[model samples]
Target: MKQLYYAALIYLVLGLAGGLGYREITKANGFTGDTQLAVVHTHLLVLGMLVFLVVLLLEKTFTLTDSRLFPWFFWVYNAGVVWTAAFLAINGTRTVAGEPTGAALAGMAGFGHILLTAGLVLFFVCLRSRLSTSDTAPTTTIGR
Candidate 1:
């Protein structure tokens, strides 16, 4: 749970930076169209920060980190976020600067998506395991 909390905080910083970076960089470049950079901040906020915060709550109720798959989910999901964000920054900057784009960055982004999907599957498996093993304690009941 502490890990999740920390991860969320870290991502919050990164997300803010991403949004600011996108705006300033675009303005500086005098670019006026949409680019992959636009979504980077939202992705970091939703996937990296918000998801981890939610999982921290889930961990309190379901003890999700107890599962063998939890660590895998953590690492893989983070890797995906980082990979995807890096690609967006790189490709987006190139596009903004009127540089030719390449397929390699797209390929890397696709792989990041794969990692994210795998991480989600693992999270669900851990969730299901917890669901089957025990009932939620009323004290920890969410949305009360």
Candidate 2:
């Protein structure tokens, strides 16, 4: 959990820096149009920050005993995020350069999105089930 928290914070800082640097570069080049930097920023937030936090929270809050599904979910979710972010970054670069959108790129992006969404859904369902179990107690008191 601590590692994930640190990773999320680092990613957030990096994302901000990347966004600002990209903006500066675009401005310096006098190019006012689509930029892959936007995609990079979005990916940094979605994959690095959001996904990292979610997984970290689950690990810290839930107890997995002899459950294989949790490990599978972790790998699938992280892989999906990585692939989606990479594809988006590549596509974004092409789009920013005024290049034609090829069928391969489109398909990759679509597939990546689907995988990421599916992974997120699976993780959510698992987390929800774990949270609803009678063995897990609420963190806060009702009267407090």
lDDT of each: 0.90, 0.68
Q: What is the TM-score of each candidate against the true structure?
A: 0.91, 0.69
Task: Give the per-residue lDDT digits (tens) of candidate 2, residues 60-109.
Answer: 65753223466566566666666776666677656666677688977886
Kindly provide the TM-score of model 2 when superposed on the true structure, using C-alpha atoms.
0.69
Write one digit per residue (lDDT tens) for candidate 1, span 1-144: 889999999999999999999999999999999789998899899999999999999999889988888999899989988888888888898899999878988998888888899889988998998887666544466796
lDDT of 1 at 59: 93
Prediction 1 global C-alpha lDDT = 0.90
Candidate 1 local Cα displacement, residue 4, angstroms: 0.1
Model 2: lDDT to the true structure: 0.68
Candidate 2: where is the Cα deviation over 4 Å?
6-10, 13-21, 24-29, 64-67, 132-144
